[model samples]
Target: MRIVWFRQDLRCQDHPALSEAAQKGEVLPLYILNDTHPGKWVMGEASRLWLHHSLKALSDSFNGHLAFYKGDPLNILPQLIKETGAEGVYWNRCYEPWAITRDKKLKEHLKKEGLDVQSFNGSLLWEPWETTKGDGTPYKVFTPFYKTSCLKGEPPRTPLPKPTLTCAPLPPSSLTLNAIDLLPKKPWGKEVFSGWEPGEAGAEKRWEIFLKEGLKGYKVGRDLPAQAHVSRLSPHLHFGEISPHQLWADVSKIEEGHDTNHFLSELGWREFSHNLLYHFPSLPEKNLQEKFDRFQWKKDPKLLKAWQTGHTGYPFVDAGMRELYATGYMHNRMRMVVGSFLVKNLLLHWHEGEAWFWDCLFDADLANNSASWQWIGGCGADAAPYFRIFNPITQGEKFDPQGDYTRKYVPELAKLSDKYLFRPWEAPEEILEQAGIVLGKDYPLPIVDLKASREEALAAFERIKEK
Candidate 1:
């Protein structure tokens, strides 16, 4: 028998390790919740909730034979090997710095014991090492990285067909799903996960829906928060319910256009983020550009709390934060708007935003989250310049012109006119009363004066630049 360990890859389709193990002999599917290895980067509550549903679905696909265990995999795998009499262990790779360290140790130890141990690339379209510059250095800028290396290089592998499996019976010692305790004790999950379906089947359904409905106007419409131009596949992709290879293959079959090219480039960005993380493992905690170490980041807990709870008084910013808190997902445009607000307008540390998103977002990946936060903070490779702070009111006016996206999340402003929807503070007293709202009562006053805060942020950037 061969042991197929399930990590981020939860699907039966396009699963490399599971396919290989099934080809060899009877496969014992196993999942270990190694909470100790990740240290500060432990899986977040929202992600854990998703995993519960996902695991249940995957187990069902295996006819209820999937085994679950918690604690160190190094300890658990050996015991599983003894019990199942498995000759080999196989799993796909994880790219987090801590995961890399843990996997290296585990692989060496397993090999020392003379067991067949192998890993596969089931997640990424291109391995991090596969797409470096001619001199063997990793690309720092995204455009050159995508165009020069990825687009100019060999295409990603065509997706594999799901392999047939001769399954092993469940071991008696396997823990029940509830015993894993992946769901939060807080009573928030039912509503947050209402529209979400978290499994391979669900991933297929979502991909089909996006291809039919969202892919046509994607190039221009993605920037508009009110439009349904996005795939909404991040959480599924992160959990490996669907593989990038599958997406790449499916999209490649379409007649090429700006929409198809742009959509593919977004995937390229995901690859770029992973490349940055693998090459610069300090990405989650430290600034990629060292000069940012001298930068003065603020420490106002009150502002942080306000930002977290979506009471920031900037409708665009508040809407984004509240959307995240309520749904475990936020629109990408909103992510940038709110990220800019936190790190620039509020002048708080990017780490603060990164940590919060890590806990809250269903798709909160270490590479994407850390790299994005640093990009917004102007401290990452190919980062947005510090002076280009997003003006929340202007951003709302531009992207959510009809206020459809903002009003849905910030319902207090639902009755206000487009004229005053984004800038309620500018509304006359009578206009406010007509909307059945009062400033600082039904809704908050502006958290900070935008012009003043922009100047302050620019001055702060100048201080660091001078140093």
Candidate 2:
């Protein structure tokens, strides 16, 4: 008998570990929720909510055969093995630091007990160690790493077909999904997940929608937050509801074009992030470029709170934050805008922005989240130059020229004209009165002056420049 463990790789389609285990013999599919995370990166509130529904979807696919348990795998796995008298355990790999440590110990202990153990790369299109610089060293920049990632022969063996399996009966005393309580205690989940369907079917539906409609103009529209051009695939991908290989295969079959090339390049960014995290485990906390250590970051809780709650007075940044708080997802361009605001405009630490996203984003990921924040923080490999500050006003006018995105989330600014929508502070007092927006009364004033803050941020950057 074999017990197949489901970690991030949630779906049965294109699952190598699930395939291998089913071919072996009777398979018991398991998803375990440990009391604690592999590290302090606990599943965020949004993630917990998403996990609950995704697990339900996975369970339904198995016809109520998927098992849920909350405890240390050290305690849970052995019981599962004993319950089924399973001689082998299988799972896909998780590359986070804590998962690495735990998996290492578990594999050794299981092998010593005379049980066969196997793991596969069911998540990534390429393993972290698969691509490297000519010197066999890890890459610090994206362009070189992206090129090296593509040269590795044909794409990942056409994502394996969904293998059939015989569901084994639970031994006994199995916990129900609700018993694990992955959902938040309040009623907040209903709204947070209203726009999403969290499961394999949902993931596929989203992909189809993207391919049919969104993919055509993705390059131009992806940056525009108001449109539906972007595939809301990050949460699904993070949870492994869909395999990267499946995405790659479907995309590969499409005739090459700017849309195809640009989208695939984004996938390469995903690969780059996993590679970055594997080599630099401290990515979530430390600066990749050490000089950032000398940079002075602020600790103003009020500023942090204002930024977190979407009252920074920058329409683009506020809209992104409100979108995130509303849907647990934010547009990619907006993520950078908000990130730059926090780390640069507010002079807060990147980790502060990183930690906030960790708690709020439905797609809160270890590799992507950490690497992305560090990249914006200007302390990551191939990071943005510290001087390349993103002016929210220009960004809004360029990407959301009609002010549609700002109005969508920051509805208070809805009645303002496109000319003054992004810069409400610059709106003549008559316009504010006409729009029913009494600046300091209806919406808080700008938390900090952009001109002064930009200067201060530049001075801070200059202090660390010589280092």
Question: For candidate 1, lDDT tens digit of each residue in 402-444?
Answer: 9999999999899999999999998999999999999899999
lDDT of 2 at 371: 93
Compute each candidate's TM-score over C-alphas: 0.99, 0.98
lDDT of the structure predicted as candidate 1: 0.92
Which portions of model 2 miss their true places by more than 4 Å? 152-154
Q: Residue 163's C-alpha lDDT in candidate 1?
A: 94
Worst 10 residues of 1 by lDDT: 32-41
Clashes of 1: 0
lDDT per residue as tens, model 2, 419-451 = 888888899999999999988878878898888
Q: What C-alpha lDDT values do all the predictions have?
A: 0.92, 0.89
- The clash numbers for all candidates, in the given order, read 0, 0
Which residue pairs show collisions in model 2?
Answer: none
Model 2 scores a TM of 0.98
Instruction: In model 2, state the lDDT of residue 35.
Output: 61
Against the true structure, what is every candidate's RMSD? 0.8, 1.1
Which residue pairs does candidate 1 place in steric collision? none
